[model samples]
Target: MSKKVMFLAHEGVGLGHIARTCKIANHLSEKNMCLVVTGSREAAWLLKRSVDFVKLPSLDGLITERARYLGTKLYFDRGDEKAIRFRKTLAEETARHFAPDIIFIDHTFTGKGGEYKDLLLRSGSEIFIVLRPVLGTREESVRHIFGNLGADLIPVLQPKVLVAGDARTSTSSDDVRSFFPTIPIEHVGYLAGPGERTNPSARPYNILCSSGSGFDGEVLSYAMCELAEKQPDISITLIVGPRGSNPPAAPPNVEVILETHSIHQQLERAQLVVCHGGYNSVIEAMSHHLPIVVFLGDGVDPIARDERRIHSRLLSSHYPLLVCEDVKELPQAIHSSRELPAADTYPNALVVNGLANIGNLVATASPAKASDFVVTPIDRTGDG
Candidate 1:
């Protein structure tokens, strides 16, 4: 018999959580029943109907903004209060009908603002939480470590089984393990998802500029547009979030995709990438052996700024990606990166067999026994 699986993903600030959930769903769809429930406004676009998807509706009190809820973990009336109730309703609806055997949650410790407290009882399914290691102590994660007199907003959602998405090679799984010392976890290698690794080529599109989310994407898009307008000789492509974000118009020389679901395809074809540092973005870019020019948000949105910068510094040390503190510094960085020889180009060091590992995990999963399954990846060579 086929199993029923549901994934609960939150937008938080960037689309990384939603994107990660969607990638896992792809591995499950062919054999098991897969359903994805998300709160992102661009859910339809990002998910791209890759599997059975449920987009939470916008309610009056709970129409949320990333700034109010993402970092502080406090629900401000930026209108998404109904989001909590929405999560409960969606979970209940899925439980009532779909009857999942396993519920895989991405990043979100709690159901919809952690309001879906009784999810285990309601669904009667094993819970799995998958997250990447965000290095450095931020005030929000720090607050969750030490308790406050109910004033502390962000709650660390513990899982019955934690899956840390780090491989032994590129990332230090030990540091990831330290973050959740109490939880039983298994190393599942990289989180590039399915079909994200591609062969590198000397493509015509030389530069690809992207910002992962809708809010901050516009800033990067406009910057790229200005750069493209000035330099007609160099080919450029900008992936601003969705059509709703209204990416700046590009010159005839530049190609702008409102959004491209296939991250690997775009990155492999490009010679270099310019993006804000998000976990999945960094992984995918590196997986395709593309050099990255990391730029933090312009500080327009505090939540976005923090979200973009969260794991950037830690990654710069291990990965070959270059970090640019200022946007104006991007042109010279991109030019300098091109000057490097073939041997100097950063090879795709982070190998991913995430989908195969996940499949092996599901096959060995015991319904009566909930235990950590340390994934032994099938192949370590170049996302093969």
Candidate 2:
């Protein structure tokens, strides 16, 4: 039996939220009918064929700081009620027709401006919120999960939360519990899917550089260009995401992929990875046990900046990676990171079975048990 599951992923400064939802949707689509209603500008091409997609009016242009970061003009501010009403109506209308068995709201609960709050509360479907820590306040999360309606709607709606990180590294699950003790919260690992791995001996001694979504990838773009100029003998591939401005001119040795559906293919050949500390990028690199050098950018968005800072700090402690804050130090970081040996197997510091864990959550809603699809990952050290 195929159950209808809908995911609502509102766009932020980057594509992290939508990319996270898409990974889960792709995993569950084999057993369920998945429809993703997202506000991400790149949803049309970013999603896989297994999942269906619908795009909402983007709020990217309305965000002044984001607009400034992207070098675009802003027409309005957050108080535009007309924009809110339009998005709310569009999303609600889609939900009324789709009639999903489960609705997963990613990151922001209120949509851009109270768009999904009322829709989520009034809808009879099972509600699940996909949250990442250090993004929003607990008070706001409480308000979004359980509005002023008290415990009356708890039984009828039965809203739950799915934290998109591991409990061992992140305090998100504990943080959410302090606010809503009764709300069912599960740490579904890193919300990243498994990727292909290549043999260490067969791979080239090259570097793969990426800034997720390219929204704030300018710093990385500049640094890579300089690195390429300085290191002419080395080969570099830079993936510039579609949503932002074009990066600086690259040398012949640097290959720039503007957009692509298959990053796993690129991951297959690279010996090292240099990236911004986005969740998707880091987790994907870690799954391959590739030596990563994180170039932490100081951006205009405080929440996004803090997210990168915290995630990089947490990963650097356990994994074999270096977190470099300055672009000047990026070359040295890269040189040092390349010498770091690849782990014989996946690191046990974090859970990489996020796709399997999410499948279990969807199976709970249907007649089938997700255990049929879940595979428990083994924990091991580099020596073993």
Candidate 3:
């Protein structure tokens, strides 16, 4: 039987929310009717032909350049209520009509600004809250998890919590369990983007620098340009996301592409990976067993910014990962990372096959049975 799965992805700063949902939806779409209701215009463009999608009035533009630079506040100025209300109305209406069997709410429990709180209270759909690996402080995580759940919806709406990244490499799992002991939690491995896995072959590019959706990637991208200038012998491919900050110039050895539809193709040819610590980018790099250097920029919000710091610290335990807090340190970090061997011996648990694990859980349709979905070891025989 085909199940109706509705994914609510409220894209705030970057494409992480929608990108994760779309990856799950694309995998589930083969045997299910998947509908992705998101605030991201990029959702429809990224979704497969089988999956249906709808866009709502987005609050993504509310963050100003100063806010992104400061990485502290999120301001919704005057007259933004109209758009907010309209978005709320459209979201509610879509849920009512779709009447999905399963609703996967990305990141937040009640959606942005509690827009989906009413839906959680009224909808008959089985609810699931999908979370990223590294959520901010424990206090903020508690707020996002329980803030909008009033007395009325507390016992009634028992949604299963699913972490999109592996628990072994993620920092939020223990904190989340400590906050809500009884809440059912599942760590469903790294959900890389929708594409065939890159062939485990020798890559031609010496370094591949990428910042997801480049909304706040100015520092990293520009630093890479400077590195390219200093190291004329190194071959670098720089991808400043479509919405990302662009470097003014690049040396002959560095190839600067404005955007790419398939980043995995580029990943196949890279020897070392240097990028901002976005979930997708980090996971994909790990999947390829490449040496990773993450530059934690002040992105979108304080929580998001801190999450990168936590991400770099936690994930480094599992892979040959290095962190750079400032762009000034990036070149040296990259140099240090290059001498390290590929993480071919890195544990195979939770680094790849997230699409399969998540798909199995959805197919079972019973969260209790998720205990059987444990990490199985994989062979890395041919992968160089």
Tell me, by TM-score, which candidate is best: 3
Among the numbered candidates, top lDDT falls to: 3
- TM-score (C-alpha) between model 3 and the true structure: 0.85
Segments in model 3 whose C-alpha atoms lie over 4 Å from true places? 61-80, 150-154, 193-205, 298-301, 366-384
**What lDDT tens digits, residue by residue, belong to model 3 across residues 1-384?**
677788988675677788888888988999888999887888866889999898875565543453464354444554444445556677877877777778888877776567677766666677788888888788877676566553235457777888888777776677777866777888877875444333434544478898788877887877888888887878788888877755777788888887776677777778778887888788778766677998887644567778888888888877789998877788789888866655755665445567888777778783222222222222334433
Q: Number of clashes in every candidate structure?
A: 7, 0, 1
lDDT (C-alpha, whole model) for all candidates: 0.58, 0.71, 0.73
Clashing pairs in 3: 214-244
**Best-to-worst ranking by lDDT:** 3, 2, 1
Better of 1 and 3 by lDDT: 3
How many angstroms is residue 10 displaced in model 3 relative to the true structure, after the best TM-score fit? Answer: 1.8
lDDT of 1 by residue, 1-384 (tens): 466677877555556777777777877777777888766655565554447677765321254443444323434353444445545666666555666677787754564455444454445566676655552344454233222221222223334443434443323234334554565566665665433433345545478777776545666677777777777877787777652265545688677776676666666567777887776777677666566777775743554355446455555545556667677887777777665443224354443566667766665654522222222222324322
- Greater lDDT among 1 and 2 belongs to 2
Alpha-carbon lDDT of model 1? 0.58
Misplaced by over 4 Å in model 2 are 61-79, 133-158, 202-204, 344-349, 366-384
